[model samples]
Target chain A: MQKKSRGGIFVISAPSGAGKTTICKKILSRNANIKQSVSFTTRKPRKGEKNGEDYYFVAQKTFQQMISRNEFIEWAEVHGNFYGTSRKKFEGLVSSGFDVILDIDTQGARQIRNSFSEGVFIFILPPSIKVLRERLQDRKSNTKKDMQRRLKRAAVEIKDYNMYDYVIVNDILGDSVKKLEAIITARRMSSDRVDPKWIKDNFLR
Target chain B: MQKKSRGGIFVISAPSGAGKTTICKKILSRNANIKQSVSFTTRKPRKGEKNGEDYYFVAQKTFQQMISRNEFIEWAEVHGNFYGTSRKKFEGLVSSGFDVILDIDTQGARQIRNSFSEGVFIFILPPSIKVLRERLQDRKSNTKKDMQRRLKRAAVEIKDYNMYDYVIVNDILGDSVKKLEAIITARRMSSDRVDPKWIKDNFLR
Candidate 1:
């Protein structure tokens, strides 16, 4: 008996305001076979957020315990709150042949790369630094100092784009979504993912 | 000053009756930036086949002269007729940033692979062996013996599918076309092809 082909993991990272979230959401809506890996977070859910759907909202104690038990594939502390992706959940999705998309930051993407080298790492770039700054300013909540700090961090993160396999400039939302979808579709058709048994049965026989 | 990104070479190969020609035609028609590499052939052009469009029809002497001059990137003699691709033309197209698609057979593909290692090699498969046999039979010129020989050759060629970067089973015409388009788009977005100066100007500074 031949082993089944495992699904691929697509890791997408971007600096803030690069529109990675919107592109990922569009991809998920169009592709039923692709699932988003909902993270576990100790941060309190905002309005309309659902536990286990948006995130596995757990208390800080539970998050710490899970980290201590080594259950998280990659976990990080951000803004004084913990966010993690469950190793069990991720492996389960992939083993069952469902493509999983992880929308993460550059740091989280780095950790995932260390653990899962097979994953397709993609970096999303805002059209320009000026555009990114304008988008951040439009958020209405960030103070001047906060905006400057975020911009600095974004510049630092953008330098890591070279580490990724593919990069998409988020100038237009629809175009970026299509490019993301293309990446997912093309990755599905890679020769490495084709089942040897299927090839034998269809052509060799 | 940053160097311009060169265009990619997409090499597509398939067994006889696998519908590679039709798929390539559709891709060329839809994509304006892509140009087909018209091969130089010593064989007489069939009815309705234009000299430069379908192929570059040349005399056997001319073909041999060009071969001696080392102008052909790859060439092969089959059934007393010679076919070759121009290395200079291909490089010119790529340098001008126009993606070039070469539709060749498995043997020709293998030869090109040795010369152009950076090309994206894609193999197209029929829905199944049964479908391939039927397609060959549908060709009115093929005798029973010819059909059988073609089927045998196809089986041999199919094994080379593993060597390709991407594989598409031509089960549905529309689906296969989309997959091919996706591969091309995703490849264009690869980090290797990105202009570093654009990154530095737009994000770093």
Candidate 2:
């Protein structure tokens, strides 16, 4: 019998209002073998957010201690709130042969790239800047000034699309989800991931 | 509008009895934009083979003259017959933005790899050597000696699977076809293949 191979890490990054969350959710719903990586955050959970399921809500002091001990594979502070992915958890899941999907910003993705070279990096883009502006405007959760700031941040983030292995223009939700799923399926069949011993045992003899 | 990008070359190589020819035919029938690259050969046409559709049949003298003129991308002498692919035709199809699939042996695939660095190489393997032997036995076209020779050749070719970008074990035809299709779809979304000008015009600006 062939030994099960280690799982793959798929990191997805997108600018605000690119519909990445929706695409990720759709992919997770369709694939039973893939699991989402829940991040550890110092920020308090909003209403209906479950611990360990949504985010592992940790005290600021505990987050700082974890950072000092070098427990994070990638971590960053946004709006003075600490957020990080645990190295132990990620490695454990991968070693157990469970593919993990991480939905993070470019900053966190960069850190992950530095620490783990095998991760597949994917970037999502809105169909156009005009579409992005309209989507942000429709949210109503942000003030005009905040919306403008988000648009500026998106412009900067979209420039980093070149760093990713795959790019998905989120013009339609279903199409983008299919593309994302294809990437995962194709990556699994990569020759580098196949076990040479298994090939030798089955085909050579 | 985005200028049409140059097309991609997909090369599939497999040992005998791996079902690669069937898979390639299915893929070509399903995809409207993909074309098969016909080879030029000095061998006589079989009962149902056509001149241009199956192969560009040529005299030994003409094949030698074309080789002297550097017209072929890759050529080889097999069983005292010359077979080659036209460099002009391959480049023309690619430059016209039509994806081309080349169903060739490992020798031709290696030659193409030396000439073109961008081609996607896929290696197909039968489920096991026992299965391969059974399938070759079922053909009954080959004598016992010829079948033995083919089995030996298959052993040598299967070792080259590591040189390919993707490896598909041909245990199930439908599953292997889906994996091959996924590879093509995912490659289209590769960030490196995306036009920078298009991104700048549509999303960045």
Candidate 3:
């Protein structure tokens, strides 16, 4: 029988410094069936970060226009920057049998889950609050006030982990990656996405 | 955030002549995390089938004793032979943190699914009735009457395809394995399995 065309979607959310981006990248690289869904962000690209690759860097005006046009599947405002995922791209990928992985914030993850009940949601956690803080501070990427703001947000974000389908405590990168890979492998074996159409076509013939 | 364990059981069933066994074996071999629970049967071993590997072959007397004690998770009669899965073994594997795959007939599969409402279930179908017959004939393992019996049973089995979580047609071995793999991967990624205990141990401290 020909392979089924239905694709799966997975959402990964974590605290800002929780290494979710790294894990998500590892997943996409390892999985042939999965592709990363780039978010359209109004925030300017950080130093050395490419525009289209890192984020679909869009203008504030363009982001607002897209929002008004119902182009975004989910959108969020983080630190004065507008970030959104394109609905068309996601729908296209899924319809064409491509499992899409979205690395988004808790709010955006929730929105996507509600909108797409079949989407797989994975929550990533730092080993500890202390470790999370230390990691954030070690980066020296933000001022003390910014770091404090992130810490407060992390506390709130941690509470939403219960809402996710799978949780990974990212204490070690390799172990977390293995767990993530396992999750992907297992989900593909799930019966929900396999349509009876294939069976009908195969057997009824 | 700690990872949750979506520890749902997956019951796979098909007629004797269907490609379910081969398909299941391929899936188990490729997916390391999924454990195929060996079932106990009172039936005499077929040619070249190993004990404890293909089945937990037991005497009829011992099988009846276990059934009387309610040791079976699920049990049913097929072709005058009794077959059952050990309840304790299933629980032990699950509690020990392994996701399980139960390869059984439709009746036993139904029993297990009913008992474990959270379990995942799937039905595998042959590409066609003709193909099923051909496969049985090719094996030359069954008597003429036995082959006819199996075909009849297959017809009855197909009726329950709608009752399963997923219906897969074993049209191609590799593709079917991929689809089955995806289902398991997605379920593991489900929100219910991602326990927050790891997060509690790490983050709370």
Candidate 4:
């Protein structure tokens, strides 16, 4: 985080196979002013994944205690595991002048919108349903039944694109990354984000 | 202009001596998607100025006829010279798939806001009142009295920056230009500016 820099939330949501993780990683690598928010989860870490960096892996008992203590910005249970974001950690990062990207689902995105109205919400989309289906079908790890179910879920989730401030169609990787970078650059200069003292001393004084 | 491409209007304004002309010029040179809206004026062209390129230099009679025919998106008179933007020419450029930038004054900007509510309106400000006075004085052409009057008027004009969607303080030329470009790029991806058919076909289909 840079001194006196204005930080805002960038809430990004995408369907199961939208390549949002790749886009987000690319954005983080290209820009020094932003970082991805590490989430807290009760699920065990996968191979080669660092405990804190991959996720704040904790026991179910600790996760439930945090939930009861109202320490999460938003949390959800999926596939018998608890996943959540810490209210203290998010505010600490943002208020200390770091733009944090939250890659969550539609439900968690909605919850953040209610809590932080000023956060910039962006929705990543696949180029087309045909393309999305093809990509899913190519993943041999998934069975035919699982692929079809995921495709149907993606269709319904994409209907919420209109709710976002910017929608980037992930048709081309390079182009999508540029658009994401542009939005961040443009947002940083927004009048509300700029220091009033700087404006007063430089422009009005 | 490209076939079926989305188009939008960007209304830019600044007080006198705010470096708006330079900013607008840089934006046009850097962006291929945007074009300046050439205005119609009854004033005679100065030496080395091209008629169509600088403005649609029209006779007073033609200007009045346009006013009577209601052919202007917004028009105003200053120093006995009438200036106006052609409604037909402006819309022709915009609807034909070109994003147009209108460099106008606060009065004209207000008129555009009323007529085209969706247009992006941005206000430019100088670093300081002292700097603005120096820039105006350095021009060497204006009398001391004229320079003082202009500065006073500028202070009042800049107070209306709140009416704009974005306010950029031109303290540094390179940074300001980059911010302007980002705003344009981000705005193009905004949901409202995109084609409904494109979204429906690509995402929903």
Off by over 4 Å in 3: A1-6, A30-33, A172-175, B1-8, B17-36, B48-69, B96-99, B122-131, B165-190
How far off is residue B143 in model 1, in Å?
2.5
Better model by lDDT: candidate 2 vs candidate 3: 2
Candidate 1 lDDT by residue in tens digits, A1-205 = 1135577899998988888878888898988889999999999998778998889999999999999999988887765778899999999998888889987778888999998877999999998888999999998878999888889889888899889999998988999999988998898888887778888887888
Order the candidate numbers by TM-score, best to worst. 2, 1, 4, 3
Task: Residues A38-97, candidate 2: write the lDDT tens digits.
Answer: 899999898778999889999999999999999998998765788899988888888888
Cα lDDT for residue A75, candidate 3? 96
What candidate 2 gets wrong by more than 4 Å, as runs, is A1-3, B1-3
Which scores better on DockQ, 1 or 3?
Answer: 1
TM-score of chain B of 1: 0.92
- What lDDT is reached at residue A186 by model 2? 88
Cα deviation in Å at residue B78, candidate 3? 2.0
Q: What ordering of candidates by lDDT runs from best to worst?
A: 1, 2, 4, 3
iRMS, candidate 4, in Å: value is 2.0
Q: What is the lDDT of residue A133 in candidate 1?
A: 92
Show where candidate 4 strays beyond 4 Å: A1-5, A78-81, A137-141, A194-205, B1-6, B59-61, B78-81
Question: How well is each residue in B145-197 modelled by candidate 2, as lDDT tens digits?
Answer: 88988898898889999889988888999998898988888878888887888
Clashing pairs in 4: A202-B127, A203-B127
On residues B147-186, what C-alpha lDDT tens digit does candidate 4 reach at each position?
8678767866776776787778888999989888888888
Worst 10 residues of 3 chain A by lDDT: A186-195
